[model samples]
Target: MFLLFSCSGAFSEVVMAREKATGKMVAIKCIPKKALKGKETSIENEIAVLRKIKHENIVALEDIYESSNHLYLIMQLVSGGELFDRIVEKGFYTEMDASRLIRQVLDAVNYLHSMGIVHRDLKPENLLYFSPDDESKIMISDFGLSKMEGTGDVMATACGTPGYVAPEVLAQKPYSKAVDCWSIGVIAYILLCGYPPFYDENDSKLFEQILKADYEFDAPYWDDISDSAKDFISCLMEKDPEKRFTCDQALEHPWIAGDTALCKNIHESVSRQMRKNFAKSKWRVSRRDVIFLYHILPKTNSIAAATLHCHGHPHGD
Candidate 1:
């Protein structure tokens, strides 16, 4: 089943890699030189925010490199795949399952807030899976749109994926990390249902729906979900920025709030095991490895001569 991982679309530079020795996979998101749009600072900013963050649920920045006019980000790859694909494959999450998944994401975000990194993009594509057997091992990746708190000045760029972009961002307001939390709400809703809460062919109309803050449930599916799940999502989707839950506080909310004693203990044990795994894993590489990638990477938007050796050998990446 091992094959060279490649795909093309908007910003066709992106590619996936699966490490052979460790059976571990990772996504290598290349920032094309021309796509930089006179904004080289974002690459630096993303690196700054990601390097300081470390958590079980958040994808670890494995390495960073630049070369051939492109920047290469070596990230922990989620193998079970993107959450959006899962919804497409299975149609929807069965209430408790969706809640469990979103709750773990809240935990990851809670950790990020502690480090003051707001992941500007928190949609299903960015939420990755480790293995089909290990759903709880999901990790949040993609720090390209991330922002760090108490650093310099607030970012005013009105850039984010249309559907998941928070309304405040579209308003072009100088926004904070809270923008990320709003996106999380959108993800939670999408996971529970088969589709997003709001949909419109007109981007403006979609923005209006988001601003108006109305979610509709048509039939049998919404009626069958739990009040607790609905209430938690409502709490997250609040339009008023002041009332929204910060990541840390969201972790303790009732929907996710269980006695943390067991989860905490289990995570600690898992950490110990992860470190041991890290030591023995054949795919291990230091940040310097990514700097190597930076040197080898091509300058264009396409993945020209991107040897899969970034993962292990010539065939995988």
Candidate 2:
């Protein structure tokens, strides 16, 4: 009963397959054996992480099967679309709305960290809606870069989308699950202002900005954003990972748990900026390119070099 499908990456495609007997639809990631030649461990790590995670805000892996030349990973189908798309479409967006979204993400990442799993790559594209319903909860997807802690040395990979990566990661310093918290802060900043905290077409400049933790809540775009919201982002985006707010601390902050997230509608400004900044073509950079550039940059370079085009929309509603 495999019918509908969509290409998700270079090596694997996600198909909406239905179980014949149960008549339930699920997303099946099909990976060709040839594609697994040198990346077997990465695939195994992703599967291992998916298998153990059962949070409501995180996608679930239902089953796994191997064919003669392919491996199939059955994942819970999520169809609401990307987080940015929904925010851009909403007519009455506010700080409260952004707060709620970040809260869900924080809770999910918190659960992962507690279990010793670090989601090294957390970005807007990976946050999907469970269904098309207006009130559907967000679901986290794409754990290909995630790593379980205590299994190996501390993570020092210069990975993650350029705009949202933590400073420690860009500095090539050993990092913890705090990297996920930093990404959440970046997302929160964009949700309120309708643009990334850091942006530059040049990979070097972009990495330089992130490495220095250089960003601002510029006027007009951030005029309506509450101070509490800015404070919240600052805490998570702290240059020192050791001082960066943990998921638990972020959740307890007034902006998230209290009533500081303003209710004023900022959709006009926020959505307009979002559409201008996050066009489909601009978000098409390959993940492989980012990783490749990170590994090849000279150790003495001013900053890690990596082009970051962004965004992804999940198929199957």
User: TM-score: which candidate is best?
Assistant: 2
TM-score of each: 0.71, 0.88
lDDT at 287 for candidate 1? 19
Candidate 2 ranges beyond 4 A from true positions: 1-10, 286-317
Could you give me the TM-score of model 2 versus the true structure? 0.88
List runs of model 1 lying over 4 Å from the truth.
1-37, 68-70, 87-93, 134-136, 258-317
Model 1: pairs clashing at backbone N, Cα or C within 3 Å = 26-77, 64-290, 65-294, 66-294, 67-294, 68-298, 68-299
lDDT value, residue 233 of candidate 1:
73
